[model samples]
Target: MGYETAKDLTAGTCGGIAQVLVGQPFDIVKVRMQTSPSGTYSGMLDCAGGILKNEGPLAFYKASRSSGTLTPLLGIGLCVSIQFAGLEYSKRVFSSRNVASGTGDGSLTGSQFFASGVIAGLANSVVSGPVEHIRIRLQTQPDKARLYAGPWDAFKKIYRANGIAGIYKGQVATLCREASGYGVYFWTYEKLMEREMTQKGIRRDQVNPAKTALFGAASGYTLWAVIYPIDMIKSRMQTDGFSPATGQKYKSTWDCVRTIWRAEGIKAFTRGLTPTLIRSPFANGATFLGFEMAMRVLNAA
Candidate 1:
């Protein structure tokens, strides 16, 4: 692969690791709220307190029992790596296309940035679908019930029960969420950075890492705001029970949405949103900061 591509991949990996490390505690709470029945906990604070009181402080980490490993540490890290790498790749493609077409310049327009994000999100969903499926399953499992021993065990059982399709239970919802969410994600980041650069009279390369992180956090908020409802459906579907004898709770994407709307009304779609919003700034800020730092280091080398 090209040096720039390799740099993107490595930098993305750094960002992913930072995101998961900074965000996993809030993530467990968010998943639990999203997947649990109504009244599972009063609200975000209540849910967090309950997990700490009942499940112990370590429960927030959701480590694999058998291997004593944090699942998302690797899973989400890889997902973020793919997301950033794909995003950069898509931007390069767009730039190349613009150059070939003799457009105004190779520099991406806002629309191009959004389109690049969509393509990145689509590519990311392939890995993210299954990673999130396992994560949601593990997260929503009863406190001590222990349905699956660990991430691999969960994968094995899920595969055995329903095969590859089973492992990717919420693939469709994931695709929808990722595409729309990331479109806004990159667009918001770019816009924020552009405005900052214009205001400060600095070149893109001269913009501060702290500023990049702040913009990334803003992008994260916009991403979830646009995609939270779809994400709710994806979480619910992933956590839904599948049985050979009885069938599935949510038959499809539409069915999941319909059931949620009927049973919980509009409020259900926003169940885990508080923690998500709380988590967004720190997690995504860490992500872009880490990425920017990694890229600088790589370039320096």
Candidate 2:
């Protein structure tokens, strides 16, 4: 009953700044690891350290003469806004129905909350699929002899190649990741934050940015735990084009997943886990904290 679209948008847009700011460096490393040919780096640290040493610190931001430090900023903001909007809308829809979850007490039960999160994730994929598509294509390519000149160039090239469909290279994988990952993501953090609120005798606003950040971090970790493998496929599918490696082209998401597992074993599931773990907490933590604060203010107003 209390959720508002304005509140969600305001919070999500605000939160996105922190999300990108804290996590961009680590994300660059993660993307490289995910898209690299098999037997590229020894591990996550090796990949990151090598990039730092060879490409210099600016490499972490995916910057160049044309692109700036703000990597995927709008993409993150759009995803958050769409995801939160879907979550809040779904929760509102279920708030009046005494279905499987709570008794319409205005407080969502665990299952209901999870369902809302999945819905949010699906909605987010609608925007995220293309946004990430461009980002990854540009990011994974080396500066010299790159396919697309820049993000705009990549967009045009992909559009020419396969039109809208090409722009959405990994929608299925993104949907899978968002649906399941976000389900556990919000449920874990929301449950934890709820317990903290109850035990600590604090209101939602009283939770403070620090605790909200911590909850956000927890949510990020929980999502990645479930979605890393799917995310690996999604990243691969997006960056598949331009790779010189033989047999890199995947027929489908399942095909990609199968081939990865068959060839690399289970470790393929978590190739870039180290950088991801390092970035998730800070990125998600700051994002959630910023979001909470924005929502508190906007909801009150």
lDDT, candidate 2, 108-225, per-residue tens: 7899889999998988889889888888877777766677777788888888867887898888999888899999988887788889888999888888678788889888989898
- The lDDT for every candidate, in the order shown, is 0.87, 0.82
Any runs in candidate 2 off by more than 4 Å, and if so which? Answer: 1-3, 63-65, 98-104, 242-248
User: After superposition, which runs of candidate 1 have C-alpha atoms over 4 Å from their true positions?
Assistant: 67-69, 198-201, 244-247
Cα lDDT of model 1 overall? 0.87
| Candidate 1, residue 227: lDDT | 97
**Candidate number of the best lDDT:** 1
lDDT of 1 by residue, 75-190 (tens): 87788888888888988888899899998577789998999899889989999999889877777777568889788899999999889999999899999999999999988997
TM-score of 2: 0.91
Q: Estimate each model's TM-score.
A: 0.95, 0.91
Clashing pairs in 2: none
